[model samples]
Target: MSPLALGALYGIVTIIVMCSGMPIAFALGVVATSFMYFFMPASSLDTITQNVYEEIASVTLLSIPLFILKGAAIGRSPAGRDLYSAIHAWLSKVPGGLGIANVFACALFAAMAGSSPATCSAIGSAGIPEMRRRGYSPGFAAGIIAAGGTLGILLPPSITMILYAVASEQSLGRLFLAGVGPGVLLVILFAGYAVYRARKEYRLAHEIYSQGGIKSAYLDDEHFTFAQKVEMLPRVLPFLILLIGVMIALYGGFATPSETAGLGALLAIVLIAVVYRMWRPRDLMPFLNSTIKESCMLLLIIGMSLLYSYVMSYLHISQSAAQWVVALHLSKWLLLAVILLMVIVLGFFLPPVSIILMTAPIILPPLREAGFDLIWFGVVMTVVMEMGLIHPPVGLNLFVIKNIAPDIPLSDVIKGTLPFLLLMFLAIILLCLFPGIVTGLPDLLMGAR
Candidate 1:
């Protein structure tokens, strides 16, 4: 068979295997190994060993585990719960105040968690119950949590950004910096929509406190004395400190991305273990185990992506596909808009990891060859990928909220996410129009790097 034909066959088979319940990393390895054995220039066993190990040995990729650990540690902390409570206290008075708070809380959690499902599960467990108790419709609660959970990849320390950096061979640190603006904008859009809904339906003007007012309940109440507030401050202060500290270090070049992640993870563990005593040594075992499983899953996908790209490269398929894209001679903006639309559609079906691993290779090279900014494309793609988390049917976030909030119907979750999804689509367009919004941070940082 011609290399192009073989490459196309491999691509189709890989997707089929993944969709058919085969593991992605194993499927790619099997396909690549099979291809290597069957094609010309038959390789020795050592060649396979060397190639696989080399791909996995990249230093740039080391940041994935550190960042993943950092997110997991924080997600497992008492401080995380306190932070959620603090956020809820402030935003609970709106019509769907807890729902809106879920979005903002997800955004904040996204900064630390670095992955979507983790963001969904953590926030859903905490925020979904609050929304349920407050009389928010179940569907809306589930929909909001599902939709809000997607912020994980758009925010800093994102595993998607790390993977993008690996696939595109771009700077990890710059990509981290680049996601900040778009992530913040998404949170604002989500919060605004929630507030709008509350006003329209519930006539809720402000968040309500358990005891009618913040001062009476928080300040003079016997339930929470002055000393208790001081104690609460410790639980509260670590989250803020970690956020500011990580950003400053990244922005100032005080630490490389991996170094910063290592620092963040170490600090997080200390904050949980010793500082707050929320996590004992025994408690940490489960979190560590969770982190390892997640890391392995991500790394496996990445390794398989490397092998798949290698197969495509050897077959000259990536180049051929780019040639076909260039042959169309389409306008850049029009082409990008079409691609973004496709991503939104795909978001409804494919998980983010699968989408990023499968589509990025085909789309990214062509887009960059057409003179679009890779950094800007990264942010746009990440946003579109996030949109999938809330999309109906297979949306993982929806399931998370549903699991946490069984009383709310599935339809309400879908309805609640509709407005936010529209807002996300708008955000995609604005980022496209002003590529500066996405590119500026990365460019500034790249120069420094």
Candidate 2:
């Protein structure tokens, strides 16, 4: 069969298998292996094994598990609650104070936990109940957490960024640094929208209470004594310290990403034991198990997806597709728009890492040839993928919110994320128009590595 035909067949079969409820790792592995066996040389089979091994053996990949461990350690502890409490105390007077606090808290927690689901679970578990108790609409509360959780991937120490670096052969540190400008931009947008929505919602809530002849204490400001605000600091000090320490280690030339991740995980454990007093061996078991399970699952997906990318390379599919795309003589901006739109469509079904691994090798070559920087493209891809987390059909963050707040209608959670989803798109557009937003930090700090 022609390479084009083979590539087409591969895409169709893989999507079919994925839609059949098979795990993405297994689906990709099965389809890739089948194609390799039938169309490629026997030696290519050997190459697949070696490729999977080498991908798994990557030292950079070590950071993923360690970072996940750090996230799991904090997730299993009181850190989430404390972080939310501290931020909520400070921001409560702002419009939509509780919701706005959730956005800031998610951003801070994303610094420690690189996984969106973990960020969602950590903050949602604490923020949802409080927001609902304070009379925030269920959909609004769940939607904020779901959308805010996406910051975990766009912020520093992101596992998705690490995977992109590995797959694209980009600098891990540079990509991490590249994420900062866009990450901060998205946070501001989300938080600003949260405040606006909260202000409007608060007013409506008060009106409803007044009509019912009930005093609405929920809209009242939480007046914290200066001393009370000071007391809230200790609850969040450990997380702040970890966040600052990891950022210093990463951007200050103090440690590699892997080493920094190890440090963060160790500090998390110590905090759980010493500060939270959850040091018992039994208390630690769940964190360990959760970390191991999640780490293994991600690694397996990485390994299998690498195998899939290899198959595309062996068949010369990626190069052919790139050549075909370049041959279309499309304007650079138009081509980029098409590629990003394809990514958004894919996001409805695939997770971020899968989207990056499966598409980067194919789309990136054409992008580079079109004069786009891979580092900037990486950040753009991340922002696009962030939309997938809250999008329908398979938006992982939506499902996560559902699982956490089972009582909240899934439709409401999905509805709530619509505005934040548009905010993500705005961030993407800003990045496109000003590539400096994505590349400035990396160039300044990492020197265009």
Candidate 3:
């Protein structure tokens, strides 16, 4: 059969397997390995195995599991709760104070967690109750949490960025650094919108206040001693240390992405055990179990993607697709706009990992040939993937927020996300127009590296 014919068959089978309710890992692996065994040399099986192993064994890929573990550990500890309390206390006086705090806190947590579901679950659990209690609409609460959760991908140390770096043979450190600027920009935009909405709707000022809980002096209660306020800062110090240490290491070139993740995971454990006093020796078993479970799933999906990529290569599918795209003669920016739109649409049905793994092989070379900056493209791709996380129907973040705020209807969750979604789009547009926003940090970091 012609290469085009083989590629077409592979695509059709892939969609069928995915739509059949089978796990993506099994579907991708089964289809790819079956095709390779039947259409190519039987010995190709060895090559596929080697390829999968190499892909999974990379130093950069190590960051994924570590980040996952960090997120898991923090979720199970008081550090997350404490952080939420502090943010809530400070922002509660605004119009949509609770919802606005949810956006900022989620963004901060996203920088550390590097996973959307985890960020949504952690911050939503705390923020949702507070927002509802403060008289904010439940739909608005869930929607903000869901929308903010997308920062897990946009922020540095993002597992999605690490995965893309591996898939595209780009630098993990560079990708991580590149994400920082765009991530901050998005957070500012989200916060600004929150402030504007709160002011217009509630007529509040943009005043900054010190962080405090219900027990603080700002309330009707008696003020605590200076010693007590000073003591609370120490309770929050672990998180500050984790953030500062990771960013400093990344900037100073002291560690690779995986190493930074390992450090993060280590800090998370220490925070739980030492700072939160929640991690007893007995908790280790469940911690390890959860880590293994999540790690296994990620590795399985990754293994499948590798095998699938091999099959696509054997069929010359990516080559043909790249040729066809180049043949279109569209300007690079226009083609990217089309690709971004498609990604947003596909995101409604597929997880970001599946989308990136399946499409990166087909789409990347054409993007490179079109003279697009790989680093900028990686950042843009992340933003697009994040959009999928907050979009309708299968938006995992939305569901997470809903679970946190059970009283909120699904339709309300969808409606609340619309404004945040527009902000996300604006962030993407800004990044596209000024590629430096994504590349500047990476360039500086690489020089240090």
Candidate 4:
């Protein structure tokens, strides 16, 4: 069979296997191994062993587990509650303060956690109940936490970015740097919308009560005294130190990504055990076990995807597909739009890691041939994947928020995310219009390489 025919067959088999509930790593490995056994030359089989060795031996890839460990340590610590309290106190005077605070908290936690579900669970567990008690709509409260949690992937120290960097053979530090501007843009958009929605809804509720002459008991914000605010600083300072330390270490050329991640994990463990005094053998064991479990899952997927990638390369399928795409001579922006739309659709079904691993090998060649910057594209792709976390059927953050706030109907949570979802698209538009949003910082800090 022709390579293109074989590639199409492999693609169909993959989709079927995944839809049939096979784990992604297993699905990829099964399909690739099957293809290799039946069609490819037996001599070409050695590539699988080489691919596994290369992927496992990667120093850059080491950052993934370290970052995961760092995130797990912080997520398992008291940092989430403290960070939320401090941020809530500071932002209490603002309209939609709780919701806005949730956004800020998620962004901060994302810097440490590097995973959306972790961010959602950590902040949502605290923010949702408070918002609900404060007379905020359940849907609105759930939406804020769910949408905000996506920052975990777009922000620095992102696991998705690490995977992309390794898959695309781009600089890990530069990709991390590139994410800053887009991440900030998304945060501002989400926070601004939260404030607007909060103020508008609050006004409507008040007017309704006044017109009906009904007595309403709304939860009032705590007015922390200046001294009280000062006291909250201790709860937050350690997190700030970790965040700043990791950023400086990565961007200042002081350490490689892996080294910085190790440092962050170490600091997180120390803070949890010593400063917070929340560490116990029971708590510590679970946290360590969870990190190991998650790290193994991710690493296994990476290894399997490497095997699949080897298959694609051996068949020359990726290059042929790239040439086929280029032959159409589609306008670059048009092609980019199509590619991103496909990514967004895939997000509804696949996790970000699977999406990046499965698609990057096929798409990156075409994207690079069309003169797109891989680092910038990585940021853009990360932003698009952020949408998937809140999208339906398989939107992981939606389920996460639902799990945290079970009383909030799934539909309401989905409704609350709609506005933020639109804002994500707007952010994407702006990024495309000004590629600098994704590239500016990286170029300045890393000098265009």
As a whole number from 0 to 100, the lDDT of residue 336 in candidate 2 is 95
- Candidates by lDDT, descending order: 2, 4, 3, 1
Itemize residue pairs with steric clashes in candidate 1: 93-206, 93-207, 93-208, 138-408, 139-412, 139-413, 140-412, 143-413
| Poorest stretch of ten by lDDT in candidate 1 | 215-224
lDDT of each: 0.74, 0.89, 0.78, 0.87
lDDT of 4: 0.87
- Colliding pairs, model 4: none
Give the C-alpha miss distance for residue 257 in model 3, angstroms. 2.2
Candidate 1 lDDT, tens digit per residue, 1-449?
A: 76557767877876677677767678777777777676636754347666666876977678889888888887766555676776666654444556576887788888877777777778788777766555555666666677778888878888788778877777777777788888878888877777766454343212343337332211221133455446556666777788889888977889888788899888888877766675666889877988899889878877776776776677677677667667788898877877777777777666666566666667787798778877778888888888788777787777776776776677787787887789988998788778778777777766733
Instruction: Say which candidate scores most in lDDT.
Output: 2
Poorly placed runs, candidate 1 (over 4 Å):
44-46, 92-97, 204-231, 345-349, 443-449
* Candidate 2: tens digits of C-alpha lDDT, residues 261-357: 9999999999889888888989999999999999999999999999999889889887788888899989999999999999999998888989999
User: Candidate 4, 443: how far from true, in Å?
Assistant: 1.9
Candidate 2 wrongly placed segments (more than 4 Å): 209-217
Model 2, position 105: C-alpha lDDT score: 93
Write down the lDDT that model 1 would get: 0.74
Give the TM-score of each candidate: 0.88, 0.97, 0.91, 0.97
Compose the digit string of candidate 3's lDDT tens values, residues 325-356.
78999898898988888788879888888778
